[model samples]
Target: MITSQTLRQESEQPRKCFVVGPIGDPHAAHGSPEREAYEHHLGIFEQVIAPACEKYGITAVRADGIAHAGDINEQICRHVVESHLVVADVSSGNPNVMYELGLRHITGKPTIHIGEAGQLPFDIASIRTIRYQRTRSHLAGARKEIESALEVGLRDGFELLTPARVLRGLQSGDGPASVSEIGDGANREDEDSPGLLDDFAVIEDGLDDMTADMEAITKTIETIGSLTEQSGAEMLDLSEANVPMNARLAAVARYAETISAPAGELNTVAAAFAERMVTMDSGVRAALGLIEMTPPDERGEGTEEFLEQLMSLDEAAQESLAQICSFGTSAGEMARMSRYLRKPVKEISAAVQQLTSAITRMGEWAAKARALAHSSAT
Candidate 1:
């Protein structure tokens, strides 16, 4: 069995950090306005961002210039949510870029926003953006700036830097306050206040529901165990009663043989029948005693029905066997006494075949019935 301690140990393993960036757009690829913007950012990422993260043993995955045929927004959003930090180029103020940036901000993750000197959007002007010129000199300068920013951000601590933590801090049950209360000029603090409380409430309610469900499941399992025990008892009782049915079947078989035999063979047939009857009676009595000894609760469901069916089949088989033996006895007697009459061999052969066929059919039916009863009990 796997214990909670084993699960915890497995979960304690370290995971690699994920990096996010923009990839599509001709400017970011070829040499367009967009390309220049992307190139400048790429140089910074490769020279500064990549090397600094490597020093810290953190993995860096660039999202810049990746061509995906699907919804770009959703892809970027997923990456942003999964990444440890997002280094965004807001130089062009592209709608898609801004959307992804907004998602990162809302996630409350470590984000470093950078752009060309004059390209930063007015809306985010308040954010301290790293300014860079389009020239190689400024690109190098931007690289160093980014490298420093990444090192600081990475060192600041990544483990406790999650959206949930920020939310918890902002709410703290200290009354309604906005992010501005923590020094951010934006009114995001107020917007997030009510939602955070609601989220916490929902989490609590879910835990309560789960606990109740587990209790119900426990009760259900107990019920199944009890029911299974009862069914077992019933089956035991049925097994015990199967013997008498066997004896009765044997008697019927003997009678069938006696009736089919010639008058001269009657004595032989009777002797065989009597011997069979004695054996069957003893077996049947023993079977009944076993059944009586079985406990009521221990009997399983459909046990009685199955036992009855089995007994019926056994009785039928015994009858058939007895009939065959009796017929053999009578036939022998007839052959001896009726040697002068010269009885038809064909008639005797047909009678033997008919009785054999009847016995075979009965056995097949009994087998099918028993199988069905066993399946239903299970």
Candidate 2:
């Protein structure tokens, strides 16, 4: 019953900005030059970039730094779309970095661009990119400039700061294609800044999107639970239906020692099947309990650990689902065997009644034959 609206309200809490940059393994086939170039950049990110973002009270994360198992590209894209701000390192002009930066542009949210000064491609060269060199001094200067830009951008709500947004504003500008850039280029005797608007719009959009994802995950979990319960109920019903078969099977052994072989065979199969079901059911129940133990509210200190465990429960649930399907198949085979044996059991019962009638008729026929023989002899 936790609705999307409730989730949205909960997600109103701010999270880290995503830093889009190229930091994959340097030793990759991209050559020693590229490797040496971006290798130290990771450190720069931690020391300068992260600290700058933190100054604005926003946590910053780089793609490789996230501890998750999924498609890396997907995670990066999602982070870019949902993050409070995107700080793109356009230094090496790496394809991946540029791709992510393009996505950020499409959102038109608060984004800060930075790169090495002389290396920028002409395509984006005109944009006011905070440039830095490899030297620590330039790194320090870049941090200061970026920190100031983030503060101002956050304040202005980053409405018209993207390439496309700038173009659109120009297409409609009554003043002129004036300011050299889109944003707090406001004070620039050059760049055109989109005048102020409500600061709440972009935040609201991100919240709505994040909340929708939460709602979808919630629905999936609920569906898995429901299906598990239904399968369990069906298995239980089948177990009850087998009670008569169990009794009849036990009677088979008691009625004739020779029948004990087949009866034991059936019993062995039944016991094995039951044991598997018990084990599978226990696993499913444990997983369900694990999920339940995670509180609706945050678990505070152990929250991350609990959430990780919670994600692992999906594997258990999947295993249970497979077992239930197997169980259904085994049960079907048992039902089929029972069906096949029914005719023989019924025929045996009928033949015993006929046997008793035959014995009575033979006794009467023998008595008449003996009397006729005696009369003939006299």
Candidate 3:
């Protein structure tokens, strides 16, 4: 399993553009659950997206090809949030793909959407999907269109209002801001100097660092899972056996020690994640602040859509970190009790129960956060 740490860049790297869409291969027939669709998508990616990226010196990749062995959700979050560009195929409105596309939409970045003419959902049907027919003869044209879209998107797409922004404006009674209303100017002193969307490189780097921290924390969670699973049988047997209470207490303490090392490691990862969350959230707020400089006619309703999502993500991350600390604290306390207690009468039961409850609740919290983090649509 390769963690993000292994993939971290020590120096500047080419901007990345992630390909989002269904990669499933169905077998049997058209519209059948067994129909294979990945090959079709891959061809488009290889022919269209890859060439487009190369022209701009950007690297094109997809979620499946990522070499990391951490939480799949974490990996996707980094890509959707940090990628300089995204080319999504709404060929079927596949729920997961749409969810990712929805997340990308909230970013208000350069996103080029393409779909088969007949497969687009009603909500997005009029959004100018680059229509493509699936045929060998038409493949070239489709690829060219995609390349053209990339060129156009990279040059001016960032200034466009995302669907989220449009919807948000209506919901908040801010009235819609047309694409032309927003000016092309950005902070001049930025590293993307003279390029407004260029600071995304900084955002990308920050998210990548956060990804590394998340991957590390997830690995420790896996370790804890293993330890807990392996010890479950022993715990049950000890509960059933008629051993001395002190012996049983010592046994539980020993069991607690088994997870102490991994728990401590997780604690460190949690702290790192918390710190990164604060930094990342601050950067996002700053980006919003910069965008807010445009006059009311140009500024699209305060960028609250993006701000709200980032804030939700930030709050969840902090909660996850706290849950991790709870687990670590329980483990530490158990280990200490084992070291200091000569004989356990009542304290042992309390410590054991506390550790068990903490581990269970931590798992629950992690699962919920992972689900939310993975879905931009939510």
Best candidate, lDDT: 3
Q: Give the per-residue lDDT of model 1 (tens digit) for 173-209.
A: 3332221221221225354353322323322343234
- The local lDDT score (0 to 100) that residue 19 gets in candidate 2 is 89
Answer with 2 or 3, whichever has the higher lDDT: 3
* Best TM-score among the predictions, by candidate number: 3
RMSD of each: 31.9, 29.4, 17.2
Model 1 TM-score is 0.35
Stretches of candidate 3 exceeding 4 Å from the true structure: 1-11, 25-35, 167-378
Candidate 2: minimum summed lDDT over ten consecutive residues — where?
195-204
lDDT (CA) for every model shown?
0.46, 0.50, 0.56
Q: State the displacement of the C-alpha of residue 46, model 3, in Å, after optimal TM-score superposition.
A: 1.7
TM-score between candidate 3 and the true structure? 0.43
TM-score of each: 0.35, 0.41, 0.43
Q: Which stretches of candidate 1 lie over 4 Å from their true place?
A: 1-41, 64-73, 157-378
Give per-residue lDDT, candidate 2, residue 315: 37
